[model samples]
Target: MRARDLLTPFPTVTPGTSVIDAARLLADHDLPGLIVVDDEGLPASILPGTQVLRLAVPRYCQDDPALARVVDEAHADALLSSLAGRAVRDVLPGRPRELPVTDPDATALEMAALMARTHSPLVAVVDERRLLGAVTLKVLLDGLLAQ
Candidate 1:
């Protein structure tokens, strides 16, 4: 199957989108990640849920996994509240992730290869810089495993 055939309508956020909104979108859709679209409506980056969680966990806790258990879980929950004023771009790491994009006509194997090479959970299917939809890992696996 081609990317266009496999893709499903997916939500997108701009670089200026609030982290709170983006987090909510992820939670509501139960997505592995949301594609970040540029002002030109082109695929920009992938905002993985893990990266958002990273914003809540203290640096010390990340540095030492055991210390996470020592801290009160409530404090960690409170930190998530602090993300309100921040934008999606703020959550991106210092070194940006490569945009995982596939052409609409690309084959399933091509999409799978791109996901594997980039370690991304979803691939945005774009046609001339315009996003058509996305092919998620689960969808791809379902198609392949159905064989």
Candidate 2:
């Protein structure tokens, strides 16, 4: 099957989107990550859900799982306050990871390989800079298992 066959509508956010709002979209949609689109509506980067959580959690707590337990729910919520005014672009790494973009005509196996290589949970299917949709890891796994 082709990557297009496995494609499904995926959520996207702009670089200027607030991190808190982006996190909400991730949670509400149960997505592993979001595709960050540039002003031209082209895929610019992929924001992994883990990255959002990393921003919310304290740096000290990140190194020590035990420390996370000591932080009360209120404290945890308070920690996220830092994300209030921050935009997604601000938190992105100095060098963003390469985005995994596949042609609609690409085979599922090819898309899977790209995802594995990039360590991305989803691959954007784009044709001539126009995004068709995305093929998620779950979809790929199901297709593989079905075969």
Candidate 3:
């Protein structure tokens, strides 16, 4: 099957979206990540949920799993205070990795390989410069297992 066949509508955020807001969307939808769109609505980058969590948690807590457990939910919320006015772009480390983009006609296997190589949880299926949708890891796995 083609990548288009496995595509599903997914959440997207612009570069200027608040980091806290993005994190809330990720948590509410249990999304692995969000596609970051450019001014033309083309895929620009992928913001993995892990990156948001990295910003929420303290460095010491990240270093020690035990310390993370000690942080109560309220404290955890407090930890995100630093990200209050930060934009999604600010959370990205260094240069953003190239978005994993695929043609709608590409095979599911091809899409899977691209995602694997890029270490991305989703692939944006685009036709020319327009984004059609995304092929998520869960959808890709289901498609492969069904075959």
Candidate 4:
């Protein structure tokens, strides 16, 4: 199957997109990540879901996971508010990963190779410079393993 054949519409966020809004998009769509598009509508980066979680959790909790256990549910609920004033660009890791992207005509195997190499859960399917959607790992695996 071609990459486009496996395409599943995915969400996107801009550098200035609110982090809280981006988080809502991830949850609402149950996505593995979102494609970060530049002002010109070109694929610029991939924002994996885990990265959002990293932003929500306090650094102390990350440093010592046990510290998380002591935080009450109310506090846990408040954690999300931390992202209120932040934008996607502000929270992105200092060094972004290689963009996981594929051409519309690329073979499924080619998409798989790129996803694995980049350690990304989805690959953006672009045609020339246009954003065409994406092919998620789940869809690709299901197609490959089908009888």
Highest-TM-score candidate: 4
lDDT of 2 at 79: 76
lDDT (Cα, tens digit) per residue for candidate 2, span 1-147: 898789998889998999999999998999988898888787888767887888888788889989989878877768768789899998876554567888889887898889888888899889887888899999999998899
TM-score of 4: 0.93
Better of 1 and 4 by lDDT: 4
Model 4 over residues 29-142: C-alpha lDDT tens digits?
Answer: 899998999998878888778888899999999999999999999999899899999999898766555678889999988999998898889999989789889999899999
Tell me the lDDT of candidate 3: 0.85
lDDT of each: 0.85, 0.86, 0.85, 0.89
TM, every model = 0.92, 0.91, 0.88, 0.93
lDDT of 1 by residue, 8-59 (tens): 9999999899998988898998998989888888778876778777777789
- The model with the greater TM-score, 2 or 3, is 2
Question: Where does candidate 3 have its weakest 10-residue lDDT segment?
Answer: 90-99
Model 4, runs deviating above 4 Å: 95-97
Error of 3 at 87 (Å): 0.8
**Model 1 spans > 4 angstroms off:** 94-97
Reference-based lDDT, residue 69, model 1: 88
Candidate with more favorable, higher TM-score: 2 or 4: 4
Best by lDDT: 4
